[model samples]
Target chain A: MALKFLVVDDSVTMRRIVMNSLKQIGHENFVEAADGRDALIKLNSDDSINFIITDWNMPDVSGLELVKQVRANPKTANLPVLMVTTRGMKEDIIEALNAKVNNYIVKPFTPQVLREKIEQIISTVNV
Target chain B: MELTNSMEKLFEKLGDLKSFFIYGQKLIPTLQKILNFMQDTVPLLESVNKSIAESTSKIPKATNQLHSVSNATELATTEILDLVDGISNELNSIFSKTSELKNRLQKQKELAEKLKSKYQNDNEIDEFLSYSLFDDELCFVDASSNKIQESIMNITIALQVQDITAQQLASVNHLINSIQEKLSGLLLDLNGKERESDKSSSQHESITFNENARYVKDNQSQKLADSLVAQTNGVKSQKEIDQLFSNKNE
Candidate 1:
């Protein structure tokens, strides 16, 4: 199944790798943003985006803040967010989960792991 | 009685004068002692005044020297502060420049990596294409036939096959050469296209390798070309053997 996925990361390399991996896994429809602010702008304009994969620390409006905003908005309240970041602190994980992130994948992950995590999140959200 | 009273007054006057003489006699020693004391104390007071004047005169000179020293100290301190500030500014500038250089270096590293990956991907595509087209098993029989024809062309007429058979062989060779040339040209075109695509974009553009494959599949003349070349090689080898036997009999 092809889902419209939004990939938010400050690193261009990381964005390309993620997009390529997703494409390899058979997800063709994807949008990219450099930071949470850009992601918010994209989301506001495109309501059809159902899945979001974002990095944690960014220059403007971090992933956690984006998640909170997404959860708060009635239009995007039920949107599924998967945080893929290098922040492995327990407190950060708890905070992200509290902010309504549906899933989390750590950095330095293989394409297979990313595919698995995306599948798990899609399944859990039933999107 | 008046004369006696006057006489008493005179006597009192005389008595007072006598008492005055007695006091003067006693004061003479004390006056001499006072003169000696003045003689001894006058030079001491003069020396003290002179010394006091000398000290008072030197005080201003000492104070001037102290002021000059203080001024020099203040100037030195100010200069030192200025020097320190200049050094600090230079250090700050250097640090900022170093930071900028570091950023540039990081960006360069990323670019080099991207270029390296692209080169590797290009090489992989080249290898795949080369393997598909030029592998030992996949080489067209026409290429070998062309090599054989070139060899025949190099040989002397003494070894040349009969003219009729040679004509037949040459015609087959021409067909084989045409097929091989077309295939090589197609492979070269594919390589050129791949190189252009690599140069134009970092992003993966849609490539239609399958389309080319389909074209290759639809080309029925290639099969006929292959068969003709194979037949020609077989006939040429038989002719060569027959010539060798005829030469031996002669």
Candidate 2:
């Protein structure tokens, strides 16, 4: 079954890049959100969305906060989240880890890196 | 004669006593007023001393807060710089990817041209002209290749993201400059140093920030040229753009 992925980012270009990468990986079903709040709406509305890829810096609701909300919610508690962001600092990484993101990938990531992170997250969750 | 001498001496002594009593009478009320004034001033002086002690106690805390503000602003500035760096790195990646896409499209277009030339038959052209339904597959391939070139052009236009990000970072850089100047003024004020208004008021003092602003300004013109070129379907390669930036830096 094809996974329904929610790709969240404020930049349209970044979203397209992520979605294109996902498409290249054979995951064509995507629900794109402009930010965390939008992601939540999509997540709530769409039951088939099984995975999330989000950027860290967003207005109103950040990716970290979105992950926290996902973890807190009973419906999406165990859903896998991969934080793809430019916030590569150690503290940011720790914060994302503490937020319970399944995996993290820094920005300017090659498609291969993204694929690895996605695979790693999906595998970890499956385990 | 002894009575006369004694009486004279007693009169002299009486005169001196009269002088002393008169002086005491004059000084007693003034002395009392002075003592009362001292009594009133003692508590006031004590209160003043207590207020001074309290203010002195808070000095360290105020200084610590100023230090914290400075540290916080510095941290914010560092984070913004990191964000800017990340954005630049991302733009570079996107440029490379777009360049690769352009090359692929060019290759496809070249192949399509080669196929078109090889398959072009004068008899078939007459037939294609006669029947609208007799569409040559090569013609479709040529059109699709042109579409690919258009898509590549669009990608090149999206490189305007760099310009937008640069402008945003420039604004952030301006804000950081303002914060640093304000912090500098605050510190100087706290330390009782002479706050040089000339230096603090000018927002162009930080060499690093100024250089960044200048880069953004230069990129603005580049961004304009890039947009116009992209519109004309004449996009520069990533290597050429990099060279242009490096030349500007030099």
Candidate 3:
């Protein structure tokens, strides 16, 4: 089965960028969510969403909170999450790691970097 | 009897002072964290600016790459096609304006350099002063050099927003620091001495403050300035900041 991704970001441009990047990598099946709350709703509604790529800073329900919520829920606990964010500080990375994000990529990353991170996570993790 | 009453009142005041110090001590770390976060925003803003500037500068290059890639393979989705088109359309105007500004600045720098070399020697300048057009030439060259200098200075000032913001953060850090220091001083006055643990905790905060100060000081405030001067055509990206830190660690 082809992997389905949930691309969550507040910026429509960034979401489109991620979507375009995914398309370049031959992964066309994905759902878009504007924020973490919307992402939770989509994740709940769609059982096919095997992976998540989210931005850290959002108006409501941040990416870290989303990761924590995902881990707390049994249905989505094992979902692979990759954090793509502008928060590049060491402390920020540590916080994301502590929140149990599968991988982290700081912006503005190349599409190739995004592809590799996704592959790295997908290959290592069951999701 | 009078002395005993005065001593009791003094003890009560001391107790209040100690309580105030304890509360102030509790707030130090959180304040430190906020200041650090604010300090971090400078680089974040600079990164945003760099990305915007670079994207604008790379429109043609990116458009060409898209053309090459699309020619090689069929696009997998409409989203990809839209994204490429969007990037091309949005950045096209910006790219043209940036290119025009870059060319003008380059020309200005070259003219300034040429003027400087022409009139740099004082003896030659003196001999030329006897000529009727010397004043005209002098005024023109001086104006050109001043214009070039003004442009360079403006670029430097623009990049210095990071430093300015960092300084503001540092000021807030210092204000909180002074408050903490005063609180500690009051506690010491009340107790007539410091407890070992309280002393250690205060020392820890002092170390953290020093660390924050050093972090600010170590920042390459001149990185943008230097790069702008060196690569008049190619502005450095966020990667330069990343590379700077990595190199520092090495």
Candidate 4:
């Protein structure tokens, strides 16, 4: 089955690399956004999107805020969000977990690590 | 009374002499002790003063050399500090330039990779075309052999027609030669008038054929050139159109 994914990042290069990596792992059904706000707009319009991969720091509406908004909404409350970011601080991890992110992946990671994390999230959420 | 006064003067003179001898004996010991103490202490005081003067005389010269050394040290320390500052500034400049060079190298790498991918794609397309156009041995052989056979067939047919026409023309030439030989004297007089009329008529026909062929060939060549130009232009324009479409899609 194909999974619909939403990838959001402020850097064009980062977004392309992530998208390419996902494609490499046989995940071709995805859309992109430049920031959390754009992600939100896309989410509001599209209900079939089930997975989100986002960078933590962005221009408007940070990833944490987006996660909070998703968890608050009834329609998207159960959507799985995985943060792929450079912020490896312990405080950032705890904050993301508290906001109910399904999983987290740090930046500069190999595609294999990303695939492993995605698999973990799908398995856990599917059950 | 005169005899008693002479006896008293003699006794007074004897007492005065005994007092003078006792005073002289005490003055001799006191003078000898003062002379002995002076001779013993004078050399010791002179030696002490000479030693103090020698030490005092060297102090100013030693102080002047110390002052010169201190000044040299201070100047050397200032120069060293300036050198250190210059090195630090140079290091900072080198670090900044290194950072900029790193960024430029990264950009160049990205562009090179993009160009490499494009070239690879173009090579792949060329390979595909080559494979499709010339892959089968039978097809390659047939194409060349078929052109050779067609040219041979055209030449053979043309030669056959020319041989038949030459044979018929040979018979007509023999009949005309026989007639010329049979009526040579009478025909020579009529040949002059016929030759003039034939020349005029043949010239008219040749002029008409030349004009017609020239007009037809020129028109055909012009049309052919126009079509070739249009075909090439279409091929060139198609690439530009494709580029525009791809850009729009991106």
Compute the TM-score of each model's chain A versus the native chain A and list the values: 0.95, 0.96, 0.98, 0.96
How many Å off is the CA of B30 in candidate 2?
42
In terms of lDDT, the poorest run of 10 residues in model 4 chain B is B206-215
Best by DockQ: 1
Which stretch of 10 consecutive residues in model 3 chain B shows the poorest summed lDDT? B206-215
Ranking by lDDT: 2, 3, 1, 4
Compared with the true structure, what per-residue lDDT tens digits does model 4 show for residues B60-169?
34434434453354455345434543554554465566556556656665665566577876675555444433325434555654565344333322222221222233
TM-score of chain B of each: 0.38, 0.40, 0.21, 0.31
- TM-score for all predictions? 0.35, 0.41, 0.38, 0.34
Query: Model 4: chain B TM-score vs. truth?
Result: 0.31
Candidate 1 per-residue lDDT, tens place, A1-127, comes to 4589999976454565577567546787999998888999999999779899987766568888889888889988888788876554444554565566766765544456577767766665667
> What C-alpha lDDT does candidate 1 achieve relative to the native structure?
0.57
lDDT (CA) for every model shown? 0.57, 0.61, 0.60, 0.56
lDDT of 3 at B246: 47
Per-residue lDDT for B93-166 in model 1, tens only? 65566556556656665665566577866675555444433334323443554454334222311111121122
Per-chain TM-score of chain A in candidate 1 equals 0.95
| Tens-digit lDDT track of model 2 for B50-75 | 65545544544443444445445445
Ten consecutive residues with minimal summed lDDT in candidate 1 chain A?
A86-95
Better of 1 and 4 by lDDT: 1
Could you tell which candidate, 1 or 4, scores higher by DockQ?
A: 1
